[model samples]
Target: MAGLFATLAIRKALDKLSSILPAISLLASSSSAAAMVRQGHEQDLEDLRMLERTMHRIHATLKDAEQHWDIRDESAKLRLKGAQGASV
Candidate 1:
């Protein structure tokens, strides 16, 4: 009779564990998915930062070119005016 009682107790514990197993599995999967999403977001932020830096460098280069062109245009105009005055 004692052996039968031990068997019955073990079976009851197994039954309870079986009922709880699905909930544990679901929690584990959800945690894993959340970690993956967080990692993806971090990677995207890093890419955006790199893109912003590249754009800033490009803007600076364009500004420098514009300044150079403006100086050249002014020099050409001065030369044209000087030649006209001499010819007159």
Candidate 2:
């Protein structure tokens, strides 16, 4: 549950970054390492990096969700079987 929330938060942040990054690049102009990164319309580069990270995180989250779903399905199936046997 906590992991899901963290993954969702990161996903939301990445989405916002994608939308606002072009404007951010236009506003960024300086010679320092951080500032230089902002000068060359390189927000796309940052966005790409963020996307890669997000993809990795989302993949992990999906795997976890699938596993959880499988377990829940198995449990439900067992309960249904027990109920059917009792009815019989």
- Scored by lDDT, the top model is 2
lDDT of 2 at 81: 43
- Candidate 2 residue-wise lDDT, 20-86, digit = tens: 6556655554335565555454666566667757655664654455355443476754643443333
- Poorly placed runs, candidate 1 (over 4 Å): 1-33, 70-88
Worst 10 residues of 2 by lDDT: 79-88
Alpha carbon deviation, residue 6, candidate 1 (Å) = 83
Residue 34 of model 1 has an lDDT of 73
Model 1 earns a TM-score of 0.41
Model 1 Cα shift for residue 81 (angstroms): 29
Q: RMSD in angstroms, all models?
A: 34.4, 12.6
lDDT of 1 by residue, 19-49 (tens): 6555654554555567777567556555655
Candidate 1 backbone collisions, by pair: none
